[model samples]
Target: MEQSFLAYLRGRTRSLPSVAVGIGDDAAVLDFPINGQPTAVANEPGSGVLQQVACTDQIIDGVDFCSESQPLASIGYKSIAINLSDIAAMGATPTAALVTLALPAHNATEIAGEVYEGILEACGQFGVAIAGGDLSTYDGPLSINVTLLGTVTDPWLRSGAKEGDAIFVTGSLGGSLAGRHLRPIPRIELATRLRQIATVNAAIDISDGFSLDLDRMLAASRVGAELDIENIPISEAAQEMSQTSGRTPLEHAWSDGEDFELIFTVGESDAIKLEQLSADELTTAITRVGTVVGRTGLWKRVPGSKLQRVFPQGYVHGETDE
Candidate 1:
């Protein structure tokens, strides 16, 4: 259901009809092909996708996020955070956001205020402005839809990754289940910095866990990946959580979704420069894990063994009755 909705939204486009020219030189009318530019073509400087980072996100009540034991502010922040992640994945800076809300329960004005405040805090963090939005009441879980506008020239797409590209990640992966989901750090800042130093051929946000998100990139780029398990970074909290769940550290490190970390590709040479510049100090540590292989699928290295595709498909969120 989620996939279908996304597909419909993606194909939605407003168009204006063009005039048909009269047959001129040879009994044939020529209409030059106008290639569809990146999704950011509609954006303008200082406003929307002046470059190529157009973002949109939706949060349903019982599913996308829970209202129980969660503050309204956190919910609002998360609503924007997910959209910002998309912008960051494109290596773009978010400039504007439009938030729409559907409120089912009759809550106090204070709750609404707190939610707005949370959204405002997120906007302040990323230099984004709340342009405008809509509000409506429904008979279901509360839902928030945020569309973030960003800009980046020569924007990175999941399809740009070619064989031999080195796989690099910004910040520690996983550990998000340890309260990281409430306010997961969008990789926008890191992505912007990476653009200056790394010749990032392809990239993505580790929102759906390393396994699935990587698959998204794979599908887009039409290639597979090879990850060196020993090299992937692990956070202390994630390690502990893994033990608690009777799982391996690698499982927590690789499968914990909502890390909000950047997993991007860079040429071998620029990867070094990116490493040096990032060593100074980062909100999160960057790590190099693997490479793009001619083999067309994702894989992980076994201890003292061969690299093999292991991790299964990552998280899928929607109205499924799981």
Candidate 2:
């Protein structure tokens, strides 16, 4: 419903000349002018050409985190990291951020300061600056909204995927709720390295679980995916948690959101190059877990069975767990 509503609104309006991308994908791309003139930079290194990419993410108490259990610094760090993930999904370098905090009237100034410290620490790590933001007192829950701005000469989009492309995911997935959800390193450097070696057909930061986010990429590209269950990388934490949860590690990897890893598709040939390059560079480990197909939904094929349709099982706003 959220995607459909956004699509409807996007279809109703036309993009302006300066708007490289208005809706959909990880972030919106804008061709900002320099000195009051329109500028479109060529996708070349050291070309002084750049386009702006922007995205926002929000988190709230009770829903995103329990303020009582989680440290204020961790909360602030997460708020910024989530937005940076969106920027990184576009294969861009984060430049600045704008934050908005909504807190209860009884909140103390020290808590606010600690949150700012965390935000500052995250921004410093990513080479991003805190440009500006807003603060407001709310009667309800505490919420943090972050808007991140970035720049890329050639931004990767989710709509460019093609049939027969190889699907890849950086790092392992699942069990973020245990600890990683609070402190995740945005794959900004890894994404930049990916673009340097190969042509990434489609890309997205995996926050809404592997299956659901991959479904979004396929939907945008009008393609289908055939996942090899054995190839999906399951993290150590996921494996450990699965022992007590009665769920398989693979299940947790597919359904548990907030992985914050990069899921991208590359041409079959480029996929090979990417593997070799990553190995040589000692970059983040990536696994080829699937392939882009001709059909229009998500699927998985077993060793001996036919393709099986898979529905999204990730977290959804206003939707109860099964």
Candidate 3:
């Protein structure tokens, strides 16, 4: 579905010269030129030529949340957080956000206010502002959409990964639906600092399960990955949730969606530096889970076991129940 849409857009729109990065990346990057001369701005102390980046994301009431039990503010917060995660994947500093809400019939004004409160709280945390938005009425479910804009001096991309790079994930994975999904942090600060200290090759936020998002990064880079099963950081929530469930903790880490953590690749030397920095005062905890391989499919190797190809496809919209 995404591919078809991109294909259609590609046919209609011409890739202009000012568009540094286009569709299929985490966000679209556009260069700002002042009166025909390129305007350069420094987002970091010594970095140069920061360009504008933008991305949009949306969520529906029943599809993305339970309106009955979940707080209204949490719904609003998640809407913004998910979009900011995309900007974070580009290693950009978010500047502003525009929101659009489709309110269902009979929804109260106070409920909508609370949702805006949550949205503002998240924006304040990341130092971004609500630039503009639209509100409309709908007969069906409530929906929240957000468009995030930002700037990056050196944008990290999914296609920058090389075969010899090492794979890493910030924080834990899986079981995000255990309350974490409602208020997951965007990792914006951590990404900014991580890129300063280590060379990030490829990056993507794990929104549609770890395995699927990792496969996306690999596909964009035209490379493969070999994960160390023992090394993948499975969240404690995933472990506890798996105690009586049919799926194992590792399986949940691979396939449970909405983790919103950053899975990135870097050089082996940078990986070692990242491990050492994580020990000292790194903002976010990172775990080395895999290495980029020359092959063309995702593989996994448990301790004392041979590498085996695996297809741990994660969540996809429009999938019918069997």
TM-scores vs. true structure, each candidate: 0.82, 0.92, 0.92
Which residue runs does candidate 1 get wrong by more than 4 Å?
4-52, 281-283, 302-305, 318-322
Tens digits of per-residue lDDT, candidate 1, 170-248, equal 7776678677787978887777777666678887888778767776777667888888878888878788788778877
lDDT of each residue in 1-322, candidate 3, tens digit only: 6668787987677753436777878888777776887645323312456678999988998888988999999999999999889999988889999999898768557667989989999998889989999988868788899999998877888887899899999889888988999999898988888877988988999988898889989998999999886888999989988987788998889888999999899999998888887433678898998999999789988567888898856787566311
Tens-place lDDT digits, model 2, residues 82-133: 9899988888999999999988778556667878888999999989989999
**Candidate 2 deviant stretches above 4 angstroms:** 15-18, 38-49, 278-282
Looking at model 1, how many pairs of residues clash? 0
lDDT, candidate 1, residue 142? 80
Model 1: how far is 311 from its true place, Å?
3.4
Error of 1 at 206 (Å): 1.3
- How well does model 1 score by local distance difference test? 0.71
State each model's CA lDDT, in order.
0.71, 0.85, 0.86
